[model samples]
Target: MPARRRQQGPRRLEEFAFINLIKRRFGRVPRRVAMGIGDDAAVVRGPSTRDWVVTTDLLAEDVHFSLDTTSFDDLGYKAAAANLSDIAAMGGSPTYLLIALAIPTTLSQSDLSRLYQGLHRACRPHHVALIGGDTSSSRAGLFLTITLIGEIARGRAVLRSGARPGDLLYVSGTLGESQAGLMLLGKALTRGIRRGLAPADRARLIGRHRRPTPRVALGEALASRRLATAMIDLSDGLSGDLAHLCEESRVGALLDRSALPLSPALRRFAALAGSSAESLALQGGEDYELLFTLSPRHEAAVQRLGRQLRVPVTNIGRMMPARFGMKERDRHGSLKDLAVTSYRHFT
Candidate 1:
């Protein structure tokens, strides 16, 4: 019989090279992890005075994003930011991260390098450590998954089930800009048109879509102060996420349409695109803003916290009994059923 050929191959070499690239890029190991990338398994310190907050998110090509309108770095940064926003919603401090990627041959190593660099840029502020992960080639488009580990003082982590009736609902930062950006990009980038908007406006809207800021500090502040009754991050649009929070708490919400935060760029874009900013703010997804509920009494304290954090906080509505169902007050002083157009996975 002929001897079996050796398993050594160029594929193995390419994977090793990628590993080395990651090692060189993220070589600095945080004290929390005794071992990080370049190991069979990572060793992380156990929580002592705090509880761990864990979250995982999967981003698939063409579904979660379209490579035609997105860059590799934007993809990585958004993936990390999404996970961070999850931790933020729970009022936890991000510490460690693990990434699993199913890359396609179309993406080059330099593309991946930029992707990792974007991830690092987003996580460095939180001092999150890249512990370990798995990598494999995919026959289809790229797939990226991130598992983030965070810590919160024991029993201090906020949940989406603590909201009570009459509690005020709040959100940090403006909304709808992301959806506006996506619409503009899809229409303009795909067709090579950038007319009717200033360069700054275009950049602002696009930036909101490509990279979102996680309200970690505000979340921590709200949690540590015991202010927020229940909280959630607006990844799936305000109406949708609020619905999720209301469902979990067995309560309902009444939103003030006029109170919905709309960025200047979004307002301008809406005018140019002949669309309503209010609709985008209500139905737009991937804002990554924190939507939280707190008692009416704590409204003042929350305002102070927002100022201290320098984050724009708006009281958009209040919670109601489940029997009331979800509703919103229109601009003409009328109430209507809240329409949730949030992004759904299966649909």
Candidate 2:
């Protein structure tokens, strides 16, 4: 007798079939499978000589982006970039990715191909392969979930911990540009509805919103060279992400407002938006730059590395005694308690 089809809902059978196939092919149970289908990426053992690094990120329509505002190619690129940044945070080299996409049946074949084209663009530079994936139709908007696997030398993978008192806090690249770009795009989109904007400006702001760069090479360089003591990615804004690094290290920090890098365009955008550059620098998210801590001894080396990589490394602050409090020093040298926060899922 043939087995009856399970009526557990669409794709449930497919999901089970996939899981069973993996178990059957791999034979031995997955060790260090820190994660699997349900939550995020599946984490398995790294090479005997290395520590494993794993991360996952989800991209959804409307919440994360809008098709009306972004190109499908850029959307795919940014989605992969986001996950690659996570692996970069651990100072690891991305190896492979498993993609799971849910899209509406209405999507055309060309649209799907364009999305994959974006994914390929982002993955190729990092030498990341799309080894496997699953696809399904959804009644709602498009969704993409990527699981990234990376590897680092044994006991050398950087983590949020390991920061100590007096270590310097640094960030690669300027802040607020992404947010400024966002604001600009939003305005342009609204204006485009009425009068539209110049082709150049529209293209610039739209590009920023659609595609973002991930500092993977810089992260690996910092790790392999032992430049940063602790590190994390700036996906959630500088203030909030800095707090994460400090919290993990059981330390606090003092950010210098004047030291932050702001682009001229971002400055104009912030001004138009009735916000300050400092505010945007502190709270703007999705920068995808590296926010890290390093000992004073490595400062020179870090600078040299930055020059080699052609990326700026700004020393914005230093780790402080937790009891001293997290504060920001203004241009006048006035110290005020800094309320560290960032964009959250629920918020």
Candidate 3:
């Protein structure tokens, strides 16, 4: 019998790899491409009336998560959820996705299968089909890049730049839970395997960090009603994400500390960690919630949407003149500089 041929270094990178290689080869990047590598999907000008919204996101081991703390399935679900959140921010419905996975040779086939299963579990409900992708081996850690495609009706896409002064600010759900969950997991891990936690607590915290649900329905609702003047996903903490919306809109905002929502679990965890819950609420990332703005006239409509969606649409504050800059009120009623800080790639 012929001996099995030794495996080559890396199979000629296909699909996205080839596309990216071509782009690199060219000195110029396409301007018509509406979205590129850093988001959930890539948007491009199509022949149709609607503009395609595209974004891509990458989750890597150690940088984004660790295997000790996160399960393979949770990691897969989160990788896709992050991209889907970007689509929701653009006021679009997710249509298709391309997945690129780089795995270490040590990982078993069963582990890889669980990871893919997680991706399918997250995508199928949103009607996002996994159309194409590429796979490669990496010596370092696991890396997943998901490219999502969405569509917005002509002239109907909500951007971060459209908010004007007096526009009310709103968020879809409570904040800080994911951060709290992470803290709980870390504590449990540090205490070693013997200092066990209740199954329920472990499930709750782990689930929060692993399976964040993007507010796709709320985003579509906002688009359909044309109620949101500007919109974005609160992926990188409320403070950071809200700052993004304000910067894009060329306006500033003030969030009442009391008005910021926090889950009970997060509050309890914060107390246990000897940290301020407000700080986590401000800077904690990966909430996967929606932050939007609307005119006063649309307040009732937006509130009605909250009722329908069973999600709280809290009006935390209003947009101010761009020159005023962003600030948030402290419990002592003092105006403190609210700096925009979030997950920055390469920072």
**What is the lDDT of every predicted structure here?**
0.87, 0.76, 0.75
Candidate 1 lDDT over 167-247, as tens digits, reads 999999999888877877775433333587788999998899889999999998999899999999998899999999999
TM-score (all chains, Cα) for each model: 0.94, 0.82, 0.82
- For candidate 1, the TM-score is 0.94
lDDT for 113 in candidate 1 is 89
The TM-score of predicted model 3 comes to 0.82
The prediction achieving the highest TM-score against the true structure is: 1
Q: For every model in order, what is the number of clashing pairs?
A: 0, 0, 12
Candidates' RMSD to native? 4.3, 6.5, 8.1
Runs off by more than 4 Å, candidate 1? 1-9, 188-194, 344-347
